[model samples]
Target: MEAAFRYREREGDLKAPYEHTEGPYPLGRWLSEQRRTFRAGQMDGERAAELEGLGIVWDTADAAFETNLAAARAYYRLHGTLAAPRGAAILDVQVGQWLTNVRRPGGLGQDPVRAERRAAALAAVDPDWNPAVLGWTVDWQRHYAYLAQLLDEGARLRAVTAGVTRHGEDIGRWLVTQRRDWARLNPEQQARLTALGVTPARVVRARQAPAKKRSTTTSGRGAAAFEAGVQALAQYLAREGGGTPGRSHVERLPDGSEHRTGVWLANQRQRRDRLDTGQLEALAGLGVPWAAS
Candidate 1:
């Protein structure tokens, strides 16, 4: 008991290393034996009370989990989310690897009650700490959190250009990809992004006016025309699957508007060399696989 008291006073916790000794006494091994005895309900009531009074933790694993949970909270406070990569750590705790382990099926130990408490604690730290969705990964969630932070800071979505990055992730490029693959996102994911002022790209033509600034007007018109072409291609794919259309083919959309989709597609292919990476990616995501090449 004297040796245990000395170790506890020095370490600030009862979690001593297995090889730890207090002077000539193997205090760590003795403490482990006490925990075993306590678990088996074989420890004397008086002795158990003494150890408990000294703040002895009978469950070393639980103590370790609490330590790691502190690290996770610190990480979240710093990064705004618990979507840590595989090697992320806080001080001495391998928080990222710990999160991965606990997120696994049946990884929270066999005690149902303890698991529930641990899960609740983690959720309190960050609700999406362990994403429950099938396709949601830590990397995706991390980027999303970063985007959310930028939005909260009043950053405009359109102004986040390809080079605008946060924590090594090109959020602007990611935003573009999300807009391009809007149809591929699950409803919940779409709803989340929509709530954050993100939406699928659409063609918005400027009102016709006198040629006061033809250069700026022409640039705007060109972008609107390209978006219109992309919209047509998307509609054509929805109706006709992946088959390429003939040059004379025309598609009548739900809005009762006719698009010369075949000609538009051919023109886009001809001008593929001029398309930006985002534009090409948008086309590729819409099933125009050749755009990727």
Candidate 2:
């Protein structure tokens, strides 16, 4: 066994070293020093020799050093910061390009609001694109679409406000309050608008459904009972007042006081420990009354 182990160890020692798959190992902190030297138009003979010893090759010794030094200087000037220590600088270059594309007049434009919105969208899509810098990239087409959408919305809002004679509620505020009414319109309502060749402004108003009247008896009773149950549960949890054990904590006495008592008791039990699925199923099977409101 010892003789076999010795032979295996010798075989392992003779194996070739692992080859680095990618070219141009990152210069990292050495980049700043390299840039300074390049700006001064000088090359370090010792550093060039070290890189060559690590299996990096150049057509000629002086050419290799000059090429490396020039590249380092160019990168630092563009980024205004160091490239990530370990990876290719390709991503950094792409981010720089994306920044430049957004700043052009026809790009995001000089409008502060639109520019800010575009910058935010670009940053969200690609965080490496510092919006403050100038650069260009193909990925900026995505940000262009987003900025276009914002401009469209702004135009629509302006048109809506311009058409409205009343200024009490602005277009944006009215849209927020009426969102649910706008969502609930039927297919027939939508079809009628389409048949008339209706404008977008008319379509916005057409989508709103008529408000329904509230049920005073059922809804009011259910709401009052639920509120009483909540108050009773809070009092029980806090262990407050010298009140009767089964009495609800509501200020107003309910019309059907017995029903409120049942709700309050159930709430108290729920507060102690929540009901399990099996327990809930058992209670449901027993035809226990549940509030509709």
lDDT of each: 0.76, 0.35
Query: Candidate 2 residues 22-101, lDDT tens each?
Result: 12333332333444564465867886554434433232322332333334334444433222122224422443332333
**Total clashing residue pairs per candidate?**
0, 4
Q: What's the lDDT for residue 27 in model 2?
A: 34
Error of 1 at 161 (Å): 2.0
As for candidate 2, its clashing pairs are 97-135, 97-136, 97-137, 100-135
Give candidate 2 misplaced runs (Cα > 4 Å): 1-27, 52-98, 101-293
lDDT, candidate 1, equals: 0.76
Question: Which regions of candidate 1 deviate over 4 angstroms?
Answer: 1-48, 51-56, 203-293
The C-alpha RMSD of each candidate to the native structure, in angstroms, is: 15.3, 25.1
lDDT of 1 by residue, 1-293 (tens): 99888878988877665446799998766877888788888999999999998888888677567667878888898989988876789867898888877875455777999898788888998998776332455666788899999988899887987888987879999898888778767688888999998999775679986744222212577777777777776655433323577889886655678889889889889877777666777787666768978
